[model samples]
Target chain A: MTGLLDAAFVLLILTTLVLLGSSRIRLGIRVLAVQGVVVGAAALLLPNHHVTLRVVVIVLIGTILDAVVFPILLLRALRTARVERETDPPVGYTASILIGVGLLTACLWGMKYGGITLPHEGANPLELPVAAYTVLAGLFLIVARNNALNQILGYLMLENGIFLAGLSTAMEVPLLIEMGILLDVFIMVMVMGVALFHISRTFDSIEVGGMTALTDWPDQEDVGK
Target chain B: MIAGLILIPLVAAGAAFAIRSHPVRRAMLVSVAAVHAALTARLWVDWPARPAPVLDGWLAVDAPGLLFLSTCSALFLAAAVYAVGYHAREDVGEPRRDIEEGGLFFRNEPEAVFAGCMLLFLGSMTGVSLSQHLGLLWVGVEATTLATAPLIYYHRHHRSLEATWKYLLICSVGLALAMIGNFALAASIPRAEAESGRINLVLGDLLANARALNPAWAQIAFVFFLVGYGTKMGLAPLHTWLPDAHSEAPSLVSALMSGALLNCAFLGVLRGHQVCTAAGFPGFSSELLIWFGLLSMAVAAVFILGQTDFKRMLAYSSVEHMGILALAVGCGAAYGMGLHALGHSLIKGSLFLTSGILLAAYQTKNVTKIHNLLADYPVTGLLWLAGFLAITGAPPFSLFLSEFTVGKTLLDADRPVAAAAYLVLLGVIFLGMASAVLPMVHGTGPVDHEPAGGQSAPPGYRPPLTMLVPPIVLAGAVLGLGLYLPVDVREVLRDAAAALSGGVSP
Candidate 1:
């Protein structure tokens, strides 16, 4: 069971790396869906088969929503926007992948030096690496992606990493708290989506750079003048 | 009763959302504000005991909590009343309707929704001050951010939208990092103790077990908490979003943000300080706070000196005052620090409210334009000038008393160097702020010849009694605090300060 969890975690990190390296918006969403599935599988393989009914319900609901519904919604948004690929990624795909590799190395090195004891109920070594990789990948997406929609995807990836950290503890967070977190994230995405739609409509471009002109201190003067 | 103080605004917010008529919405807002102030005053008179109604150890009203709550409730009531008058004077068309052709902006009538969200924002801030559980406090803080986003975008101009987006995204990221810190704190608890499992991340619980917490993790957590909450508090290096948001927001909203919201964020940092002190890490936490405080003061001084927009300068002033408050607390002077927080809140609230009036009358936020404020609007201009003096810690103002107290406390503690540095920063800030503000207040530039917003105030363009009265009342309160601290209020400050200093005066 532990080996299965570790394999799933590694696969999740790979999917995250794929997300970081992809310029195609639709492909990135697909990678996120795959990553979400790995998280659900890892959750299932935890040593605590005595998991409370509430934990099961939360995992079930979160997995279904995150892995299936969220992906579909994101894909629909991409299709609506009709952007085939992310042109001029914030950082090139190669650099993002290199940064992910560095993050993964640092995670392993830190774990060795810190020598922090892992939780007894589950696999410990795999936990920190998974979290670090996912977090790095999320940051990559956020920094490299040009579209506001893709940034939201990165935020969700970062959240997934944090969720994995919580799962490593083998303690069931209260259902209400979990629900609150999920609801807040949902509302945040909805708000950002609306803002993105408005931005697109007004600027005639969904690119994040277009909004920079709205700042009081614009870098270029002659464009609008 | 503590719960009622928070719930009333929340219910009023919902009511405001349901009603469409501007008059009805405005009336609901005023009534709620009046009732909130009245209830808080009653609480003061009743002198509620310590730990009034602890909810599963998640919510409690102790001395410091009560002090902040009362101050916030008072300031919010004033801002709410003033908002009605300010809104009434403006044309009720869509805010983005006047954007230049080909400009990147969208306009909509979210005024009713905006008004409703402001009330909710007030409620959430109140919740932040009153909350005992760390989790509840986090919830309240995040809720304030969400509730106020619409209010920030109330103008719906392209610039306003950009400001709102930055405020939302950066603050949310900072807040999320704070949540990770919170989890770190929870994880640091010892597993051997039976009661530790039941520990609910309440401030009291964390403080009680501070000595047993993992010191390394606690230190990391404190750093994250400071950076995270400090971002919201508009501390330097992390305060890039503040001026833009404050400048673009409606004046009434700006007042609340500068006055009430920043203090709530400071409270979160103070909570972390309490935990760190109890955990035998006082020096570490204090040094970090002082570093950030001094940096914030320096940055504000520079920005204020070079500031072009009058509103942006005021925003920087807020940042400067927050720095002073942080420095006072960092000095480990309990009484002086408590007084500084109170004094700053009252005076800053008054200044922002008055600045709103000036902006409304002048029609432009540019510091160079619209001179002879006293001649144009005698009462408001005088109030604005007085507010400037009071905020800069001039003699005979409450801030002067508070700042002097901090200086004395530092000297008594044998920190002459820090005291000197603080004075220098304060002097620089004073000079910078005065250069920008004095011109607008006293210059002989042409009076605002045209009625602002193309609407002549009906027959008599005098500000409504609601808008004019609150600032005057607040100014009076500030003056009273400066000249003579009431016995009961003094006693409350003493107790609160004592609590902060861990019962040690030094």
Candidate 2:
């Protein structure tokens, strides 16, 4: 079980790198799908003491959402917007990959020095470090990407990281409560999907940087100043 | 009965998507508001100034929850009423025709989506108030964000699209952090106890075991929760999405977002504060809130000074008032914060509604472009000017009483600096807002004036009666609350404040 967790963690890290290096929205999303599958596998492969029928059910639903439903929605949004590939992001692919490595090193360093240990031994040692990496990489993607689609992908990665952390803690939060939170995210992506369609329709592009038109910068009154 | 709050809105939303007629959808929206308000009133009359579960221990109306529910129900009804009247404009009544980019364009408004989302948004808010479980509360608040995201793009223009994108992205990240915060709060439970299967996210359970829970872990958790929920509440530094969202969203939607949603998000902060207070470190959470509150006020004051758009000015005022509510809550004046929220909602909701009226009549949101409001539309102008006064915490208004109580509480807490800063920021806001509003409300009409939007109404144009009356009704409610706090209300406020400040009950 521990070995499986380690392999899954490595897969998750490699997927994050793929997301950072990829320019095609389609490939980026496919990488995200694989990452989601890895997260689900980690849960299902949990040591017998930590596994439950409800956990299995949740991982199934989560897999469907992160892998199947979300990709279709993003693809539909793409078709509606009539675009296939993302423009070069604000952070170059090379730099973002380096940032990914930096994030992993920092996460491991923090765990070693920062001493944020659990009250007991965690389910897997790599869980915390992998979760931290995914979260930081997600934040980086959100900030460094120019495309709205990439931002959404980043958001999904953030959720993935948080999910990883929870499983590692083996916290006893109920299946029902977890489902309720997941439903909120489900609706959230759906709403953002609709907004993305609307945004692409209006601006004819989904570039986050193109949002400066509505700002209060050098207010209309202070334009000359 | 408690379940009805969540179910009714969901049902209405479904009906809204099914029913295609514009007027019926509008009626459905307002009817849900009415029923929701009636349900809230029943609960208010029955519930005491303490926490008690009514729905199998999953849902409860406590003091703070009741306070927010009342504010939510009232503003929702008022905003819906204003939406009904505002729909009579060309944008809603028929397909809009425009010669844009040198071509003829026509498009029908999505009335059903707008009306349905508003109903669902109200339900999400009510769910937040009635929920006793922290996970449920997070779901409820996040649902509110999702439900209202589409409503921000009601006009379906480039600017509206931009606003919706920013609103969704910034808030989603903020609330996701909040979810991580929830995880942190959960992790604070002792590992042995948690693994032994005694973990519960119910507010009561968490509060009961707070001292046994890890304080350091909870404190760190509380920080994440603050930033996450604080973004939704529009606290300074986390409030970048607010001004655009408020100013771009239709007036009625703006009213709900400012008047209700910010308070709903504040309820999350209050829950975290409750746990911290229980953990024997009341000062830790309270200090965090005070610094954030003060920073929010200063930021709001700076923005309000040079704000040109009336709607945007109202948005910044929301940030300022949200700052006031934070300060009030942090200083241990739960009663005052509750009243301040109620007073602020009524006054500000009316102000936003009247701003809608201004939009309809003057055809521009730009402050300088608006003139002779008092003469051109007497009912709207009086409500607008009165709302501005009431919102600025003038006497003979409920806002004054709440602001005074909040300030007095701050002084009593021996935070003279915070109290003084509160007063000073309020003064700055008033002067700045007065600089924009006074001229618009006082000036006589300028003949042959060119409208900023190129679609200004005739000088004597009158909006529908529905639009004018909601603000009038809201302004009156503000008056009633100022002149008298009913015995039941006073009990609720006192109890609610006591309850929020980590007391058991009366």
Candidate 3:
């Protein structure tokens, strides 16, 4: 079980690296789907987790929504929006992969030397560090990428990271509350998809870099400094 | 009963979508708002006499919750009333030109979506106020973001679209971080508690056992909670989406966002603070809050100094007041913070509604282009001026009392340096806002300034009574509170303040 969990974590980390370096939206969604499944399965592999009907249902629902549902939604959105790939992200792919490596290294280093421990004494040590790395990677994806679909993918990755952390750390989260969290995530992704569709429709592009009409800075000519 | 308070609006939101008639939906909106307010008032009036039981420890109305809940209820009522007037003006067949993209035209989104989202926003905020479980509270906060995204996109234009996207994505990401914070909070439980296999997020349970919580995990939880909810609360460096969202949304929606939604987000932070305080860890959270607070104030002041759009200026002012709320709590003036939250909500809600009227009459949001307000529209002009005065901490308003209380509390706490900085920031914000507002309210427009909207309202047009009354009523309430916080209200505020700093978390 421990080996399985470690393998899942490795897969999660590697997929994040692939996501960071990839510009192809389809490939990104596929990688995210794989990552999501690994995270959902990793929930079951957490040490001391009681395998019950409710937990199984939640994990099943979570895995299906994250792996199959979200990807299909994004692919549909991608098709409708008529965008093929992420174009001209603020950060380059090679640099992004390097940054991902750096983020993973930092997390590993921090876990080793930073006196970090789970609330429960017997929980797996790899869970928190991997979770932290995935979260940072997700946030980096959102910030560094200019594409809306890519950002949504980043958001889902972030959600997956949080879900993993929640499963490991908050062992006693109520089944109903877990359902609520999953439902919220589902609605959030739907909302983002619709909003993305609207953005593409209105701006004729889904690039967030074009959103410059609203700002606080005084125009240069008006400031005349 | 608490469940009903949350469920009623949610059901009405569904009804709003199903209903065909626009007027019926609007009527239902107001009726729901009124009922929610009445029930909230009953919580104050009747429940104290015979205390109600918590619903399975999932939802409960404590002092701070009730206070914030009351504020939300009251503001929702005001915004609901104001929205009727707004839609009456806007929902016509007029193809309003998109101001951001010149020469492009747009129409309002479906009335069902707007009305449904409004009620849904109310429902979600109610959930936030009543939630006794941290996980439930996180759900409520995220639901609020989802509910209001459509409301922000009500105009169905590129700018509103962009604003909606930013609001949806940024807030959702922020809230995801908050979920991580929730996990960290759960992790703060002692191993003994964890071994019992009943590690729940019920506030009372956590508060009872806070002393045994792991300090390291508690610190981590507090950081994530602050950053996560702070982003939603419009603290500086994370407030990037606020101005755009507020300005793009309809004025009534902006009012609700500033006055109600932000307070609910702040309440999320306050809940985290309550837990940390119970766990004997106040210094860490307090220091971080004060820094974020000062940064928000400084950011607001700079933006307000150069703000061109009137609506965005009000949004920035909200960030400033949220900062004040944070600062007051950091300084241990929880009592004053309670009053400040109420006063700020009422005043800011009124100001945004008044800005709606201004937007209608002038067809422009630019401060310089809008002129002769006192001469052109005396009532709106007075309300506008009153909002400016009240919000800037002028005498004869509750904000004055609250701001003074907070400053005095800081001084009494032997934090003269912080007190001075607080005062200095307040002074700068006042000046900055006045420079923008006074001219807009009292100054003249350029000689060649012709109203720009393709279908501008006629000169000397007056807003209907429905629109004018809500702001006047809200502003009047703030004034009345400033003059004399009735015994019952003051008592409630005191209880709320105590709840913030109470030895046990409420």
Candidate 4:
């Protein structure tokens, strides 16, 4: 079980790096879906003394939402917005890949040196570090990408990272709360997808860089009349 | 009983969606708001003492929550009444021409969507106030973000679309971190407690087990909570979405966001602070809040200094008052924070409502272009001037009392320098806001006061009583509270403040 979990963690890291390096939105979505599936698998594989029917059911629903439902939504948005690839992110793909690797290394080092240890000694050692790396990489994706769709992808990565972090912890959140969290995430993605449609229609492009009509620069155009 | 408080509006929201007639939908909005307010008032009377946790300790009517809940309920009623008049002017069920896009026509979002979202927004805020479990509170806060996004996009223009996008994305991300904070908090439980399945994120359970918590994880949770909820609360450095959303959203939505939604988020932050205090780490959270509060105030002061747009300027003022709330809580002035929260909400809600009237009359938000407001619209202009005085902490308004409470606490704590900085920032903000507001209210009207291409007020336009009464009533409440807080209200404020301060002081 530990070996399978470690393999899942490795897959999560590889997928995150691939996501950072890929410019094709479609391909990026695929990598994110794979990462989501691995994360769901990891939730089950974690060494738990008691794994009930509830856990299995939640894992199934979560996998479907994160992997299948989310990607389908993003793909529909992609086709409707009529964009194929990220043309010019503020940060290049190579630098982004390097940055992802650096973040992964930093997370490993920090966990090892920072004396961060889970209460359950039998928990996999790699869980915390990998979760931290995924979170940072997700945040970096959000900041470095210019497309609204890419940012939404980044937000999903961030959410997935948080989910993994919970699995790493010893705490037992109630199933109801877990479901509430998942439902909130589901609605959130739907809202963002709808907003993306409006952005594309109103601006003729999904580049957030062009959506600079609202700003606080001292000399910006007056918004009054 | 508390479940009904949350369910009534949510169920009404579903009804609003199914209803066909716009007038009927609007009536539903107002009637539900009135019922919600009456129920909230009934809460005070029924539990004249203290109410126990309802729903298996998942929801409770505590001092701080009640204060916030009442404020939200009152403000929603005011916004609901004001919305009726505003929407009538807006010509619901008709495709409105886009003024920003040079005569291009854009259909307004369905009035049903607007009313439904507003009701949903109210229900979520109610959930936020009543939630005793951190996870439930987080759900409530996120729901508010979702419910209000459609409201902000009601106009269907590019700018509002942009505002809605920014608001939805930024707040969603921020609340995600807050979810992580909830996990961290669960992790902070002692191993024994975890093994016993006592790891739910309920406030009472967490506080009871505070001494056994791992301080390291507890502190980590507070940081996440501060950043996450602070982003929603419009604390500076994380307040990028605020001005745009507030300025661009229809003014009634702006009023609700500024007046009510921000308080719900602040309550989230304070809940985290309560846990930290129970965990014997008050100093850590206090230091962080004080610094963040000062930073927010400083940021608001700078932007407000020369702001030309009246709505954005009011948005910045909301940021500044949120700072004062944080600072007061940090200084252990819970009573003052409660008083200030009440005052600021009513004053700011009235101000935003009045700004809508001004917008209707002038068709412009630029303060420079608005002249002779007092001459043109006496009631709105008087309300605007009074709101300015109240918000800026002028004498005999609740804001003045609240600011003074914060200042006195700072001085009492031997933090003279912090106290001085607080005063200096307030002074600068007062000057900044006064310059913009006074000119708009009292400026002499030139021959061509209207901006180029600005449409004159709709022919024979007179401010409807519904539009005028809410602000007057809101501002009037602030004046009354400032002059004399009723004994029960004073007791509630003190209790709320004491709850936040861990009963250290009244």
TM-score of each prediction: 0.91, 0.93, 0.96, 0.96
Lowest summed-lDDT stretch of 10 residues in model 2 chain B?
B97-106
Stretches of candidate 2 off by over 4 Å are A45-49, A79-85, A217-225, B49-55, B90-108, B444-458, B503-506
TM-score of chain B of 3: 0.96
Query: Candidate 3 - CAPRI tier?
Result: medium
Across B199-229, the per-residue lDDT of candidate 1 in tens digits comes to: 5577777777788877877777788788888
Candidates 2 and 3 compared: the better one by lDDT is 3
Could you give candidate 2's per-residue lDDT for residues B1-506 as a string of tens digits?
77787789889988998897778888888899999999888877775633346655668877788889998999999988888777767444554543222232434347777787888898899999988878788888988988888888776666667888888888988887887777777778887677675757778777778888887678877898899999999999899999999998889899999999999999998889988888888888889898898999999999999788888899999999888888887888778888989999888899998888787676667887777677767788889889989999999999999999988999998888998899999999999999889888886435577556543343556778888888899999999999998898898888878877863433
Residue B253's lDDT in candidate 3 = 93
Sorting all predicted structures by lDDT, with the top scorer first, yields: 4, 3, 2, 1
User: What DockQ do you compute for every candidate structure?
Assistant: 0.31, 0.47, 0.56, 0.58
Candidate 4 overall lDDT versus native: 0.87
Query: Which pairs in model 3 have colliding backbones?
Result: none
Over 4 Å off in model 4, which ranges?
A218-225, B50-52, B445-460, B503-506
The A-chain TM-scores of all the candidates are 0.88, 0.90, 0.92, 0.92
List ranges where model 1 is wrong by over 4 Å.
Answer: A44-50, A79-82, A115-123, A143-146, A169-180, A213-225, B48-54, B94-108, B194-196, B410-420, B445-462, B503-506
- Candidate ordering by DockQ (highest first): 4, 3, 2, 1
Model 4: DockQ against the native? 0.58
Supply the TM-score for candidate 3: 0.96
Model 2 CA lDDT for position A40: 86
